[model samples]
Target: MTPPSPATSAPTPTLLWIDASAGIAGDMLLGALVDAGAALDDLQSAVDAVIPGSVRLAAHGVTRAGLRATKVEVEVLVDDPPHRTWTTIRDLLVAADLAEPVRARALAAFARLAEAEGRVHGIPPEDVHFHEVGALDAIADVVGSCAGVEALGVTDAVVSPIALGSGTVTAHHGVLPVPAPAALELSRGWDVLAGGRGELATPTGLALATSLAGACGPLPALRPDRTGIGAGTRDTPGRANVVRVVLGTPTRGTTDAPVVVPADAGPGGTPERAVVLETNVDDLDPRVWPDVLERLLAAGAWDAWLTPIVMKKGRPAHTLHVLCGPEQATALGAVVLAHTSTLGLRVTSVVRDVLDRAWVAVEVDGGTVRVKVGHRAGRVVQATPEFGDVAALAADRGVPVRQVLAQAQAAATAAGVVQGAPWDPVDGGPAPA
Candidate 1:
């Protein structure tokens, strides 16, 4: 029998892939956006809205490693500007009259920067002084890049493994190692590579990349409509000091339409493509499985489980299954190889159709418990209390786990919590009363 033909319809959302082979910086990204066709006037307008004529942005045509690119320069108009704190920056962004999406992206990037700085300085994000990155120029770079991205109408972003340079860099805190403390903090979970001999990825650059990139890996199979090259200020002899941005649509081969599971069935999941990694282990002690699973989860595996199987010579074995975003497959696979006895693993790309879901917190016995609400076709269908939250509440209140779970579900229903509501799991935290 012949195979079915691939779907002819275009993918619903578009993807923008960033090639950081040369390295990435805030100005570089902004320049790339302008080169890719974002209007400098519009980007400047957005920035001006936030800072009110404190800076000017310009993009110049340049060559790096013999490749033509755009180099963005930020000219600060203010003399002796105040070094802004995270709170100050956040307020400025929030009060800006920019487009909602652009404002949100810009604020998120700054928030990530603040978080990284806080981690390095041992302070809360609100209190962290931005130092060099808090200046008018850096602020303009971040805001302009974000506004440019929004102007391009990109729905998702994919990034190559970052190239972090070696050696040391001078900062307000004195001499810092290459990749810097803030860069290191920003790159905590994602893939990073070392190249060159200077500071390649700055803290602001890292924050913008991490904030926009939904996945990180090689450029996906795409039909490119436009490509932009953003050049860095310094020219390295052997390498291109530039960041590449490719705008395109993912190539969708013949595949079945996503199967939308009912909300009552379980947690709704991502609608994008995912990877399934499998391996068999027969020699490792059973006692080691728990630790291995924990490590995999911490490493960003979406879900992991083990299945019993019979191997050759009547030996009992276990098959480990790991499901994760395609961008995360390589990193999670490394964990499996290093922590397990398996010599090889199998990987396959799969499509997942998930019901939309949201996390809400409910008050029970003076403590809060989180509930996972799943929605299908824009209606709530499943409401399940998070086991971890239920267990903690049960322990705290000295009540049966079932009692806590029941009460939480009831509270969620009363609050009119449903799918399709505006709730960000990361930022919303436990919902407040």
Candidate 2:
């Protein structure tokens, strides 16, 4: 009788948790799902759209093993159950016309299960036997969930501790241990809770939740847009046996902008959320530059670089620039002192009108170049050419590095491969690289 933790952090990202102590088979989950209010009809249409031929997913409200729930069953026209292998799943997905990455994720999960089953049974990873029930049920859960995600437009999946109901469950291998082998194998490193009268986390839940979540960890802050609760068959005296699916966006309170300063230390300041630390030095050992950059990176600087320039009176000086989050000011200064000979470093909290960035490979005249495209305020603001790629191609094609860099940029822009910004200052702009 523990009071539910005070409405934890206001939901930020979409998260889901399954409390399966009473017993959560597919049917129970489907029932609770109806109660949780997932758009079952919409999901059905999505499945049909994604998978050819009329597909009907039966989601009817019901109770299981003395618990109220909804039952979901999908009936596909008679055909071979489809060979149940990693590639078998792959080919079915290919023929069904589902999304590529979605198909890949499901296949990877199946491959993991096959691997674990192989290890547990001492068989080849590919040769592990999956019974007809297991294969059909796994496919239904994986593909359906993928379709649901696509319908929900859920980009990320996070999970809470899976409460594993203890006791025996019958599988094709005859009555086996709770969690079964496949489920146990997938549960490694995740928080698992047990203390029920039946199997809580079934293999289907294990494979789906663990594999797609990217990483298993505690629920992150999120904004709940929708809450869908799927039920387990067990009904403890005072608890609801269910899984909760919360969908939402990330709340933005995790970051705080530091006080701003004038760009040139003049009378006023400019708008910018990012900061830069810089200093000029002519009286330092050149041997320390590499170590200095490394320490800056270790200290969490977004970028640290030294630009060689001719100083006043014809002396050669190196300008060190460190770009970082505003909160990084104190730590970066310490790093500067520990690694460099500069006694004073100028700090500026300036707005970095940054653009969303994505990596794209463009076909340059000489060869291929991986260009990073950036966008700001919905317009591409920068396209930074990959330096090493240009250098390598230039050397190979007997062309000047500058020419190679230009060609790469042109190619990236021509193909519309990099959507956002292009690094305008060709020889400028440094990163933590």
Candidate 3:
């Protein structure tokens, strides 16, 4: 079917420009949204949907680097908040009664955090357990930020080039560099810099900004509506350690649709460097292959797979392949050597072009399934429902998995996530503006 032309009457999407030049954190962004006129009640209700009275949101006026701003604190109501895995949190969000946009944004943020943490520590994304990031306060910050943006009627977001910091800081994994591995990993493909001393941009903050905004660069042209400043924990000398959120409408003759663009890409696309490690083994136990692949993934390998091949003696064997980043080549190579029976391996450097991707949630039979959407040049090219979610929903509802898949695809299409559809991640269409 032919697609409809851009509606002349369709209102321009409200643009949310995140100014993180000073740096950002979950609290800082949340506070900025509140200071910019996000309803406190709406933020509270959204947090309560998933965590259920676990945290309280409070905002107050403050000064940072001699600049007055707002600081929102997430107070934990319970003693010793439990650490949650990505799976546990994802399930909680899927079952919660949240606005589609809020839920989708939160889920996407947490998902990015999980992937970054997993790669940093060498574990499967779902199996990676959280420490500080899984706490009640962080959860509140993520949920609150998402809800606050929706409350302000934001339809699209554009984040400034991030301000990563210098020096060293300690985390759940012990003392790490200023930016932290997870933070750096999350900011991959986006513009970033060492903005100051100490750890400025945090994992939670980077995840929220990267996942929600998609577009990264200097502020685009827009007629400003409201500007809010969010204060960080420390009022450092010589700089305002804060994040500023600018809410506005697109200027005339300009489109407000935001698409994920790689910071280092050329006109068509950019090629990224990666290493492929491969080895053929005929004597290893077949049962051990699965464990070997799992270990490789845990060792920061992007992917691991096995192919059937016959050796010189016509013996049936498996050829294992591991793909990883260049920086991870040594560590992943060691993992490959230790797990497999092969004494040697073939290593090749390769370049790959990647499309921009994001996640959105759709409801099927009252259950939520996340759909992974891929975009290029500001238009959606592909949309696919996560089969794991589809199967789980099918099992819970006592329905065939295929039926759930069909429903999810249909829902995604109806929500405007199909190929050639205009880019808008929020379900039920863009927030009323």
Candidate 4:
């Protein structure tokens, strides 16, 4: 038989599944990347570019519970650098001459950390002081790991339930419980295990995992191509002190194929494949519906809503429906199952046809407001101010909401974004006169 032509076969999408069952830390994650074929020299060079000559990186082969792994060590050479704030770190990362993707990933990971720290300390994220995590070693670990991720070309990431470990850990702020306040804050809404002794998941590890992974669950069906074990420093008895990363190609379902709608379709819209998950509940407290809707949206539901209905025996009920991308179906479904009283849910694949829309920022009264433009056949069909931005501007300026809306629409019209007449403030509506 003649060999299949390479051009005929589609390239498989790469996925990196992290097994944090033993827990995760920044060094452990970097070590995992090193073992999985990310070039240590490249990682070192990237870290050097970001943090200068403040730290040295080393990767050593080791075994955790008879399983081979890689251990990464970061040696800080600088003598007690000033405690940096979140703003300082963000400025440094943004100014560094790094690849755009690497810079973005590093900044996102740090932003997650900053947000968690800010929440824990009751302060703004920009003003949050980084104590131990602001050190050169932490910087190297975070930036180097992100660089490695970029180098490996791993596009999708999934994390297993993290083992949080138990007990107490002392920080610069004082004696904090195991899993620390920052770690706990980061792990909120994430699957976490509190078994085992001492700290398993650090704040850095939680931040990186939560920031990078789009979904959290058991390993999806995939054909494993490579595996790497990252060893942790502590050796708790009866368990392997390592995090495992598996790289593979998904064996189930289509690989994110875009469903293009025909030009003759209604409204010349582009339709994308999505899944609709739904359930009906008649017994839950009505006060919790708002929170449920909010959680579903936060958990990656593109849109979620509740509809009033009549259940058996004329009992009033609600039908909760969530729309999301196909990849998030399972995770979001789990969210519904966990948060609601329904024992089961209905999932159906759907195609959502939408107009070609773009967001453009318009300056109004000192602050920038975003306006959404919907186009059909390359011509603007509808232009509207984002209500959230309009409301914020209105509150800040102590003006009517309609006035802010008019100003934003007028700004959009002035920029030639919309073809028709602008909204008139005097008439409080779109203008033709």
Give the Å shift of residue 373 in candidate 1: 25
* lDDT: the better of candidates 1 and 4: 4
Candidate 4 minimal-lDDT segment of 10 residues: 1-10
Where does the lowest 10-residue lDDT sum fall in candidate 3? 1-10
* Clash pairs for candidate 3: 122-298
Instruction: Count clashing pairs, candidate 1.
Output: 1
Score every model by TM-score.
0.59, 0.52, 0.58, 0.59
Which tens-of-lDDT digit does each residue in 1-433 have in candidate 2?
Answer: 1111111121233444434434344444444444556567755543554444534667755443454555677676536544466445545554555453344445555655666777778887657655554566566666666556545555456566777766888876799887677677767877777756567777666766665553344545667666665655455565566665666674644224364554553322224466788999888899979977876675446788989988899999999999975534544554564356777779886766433455556677736777765544334455678799999999999989999888887776565434443322232222211
Q: Candidate 4 on 1-433: residue-level lDDT in tens?
A: 1111111112356788889999999999999999999999999988988778888899998878777889999987778766888778777876787665566567767877888899988998879776653567678888898888878876678899999989998778888898888998999888999868889899888877876676788887788887888899876567889988988887754234457575665655767778898899998899988977876775546799999999999999999999986645654664565457887789897788776555667788777777666655546667777899999999999999999889887887776557543433232233343
**Per-residue lDDT of model 1, residues 242-340, tens digit only:** 999999877753124454454544443446678899998899999999988876775446799999999999999999999987645544664675568
- The segments of candidate 4 whose C-alpha lies over 4 angstroms from its true place after superposition are 1-11, 132-134, 253-433
Error of 1 at 319 (Å): 38
**Which ranges in model 3 have alpha carbons more than 4 Å from their true place?**
1-8, 132-134, 252-433
Q: Which stretch of 10 consecutive residues in model 2 shows the poorest summed lDDT?
A: 1-10
lDDT of 3 by residue, 257-295 (tens): 434455666454634566798999999999999988876
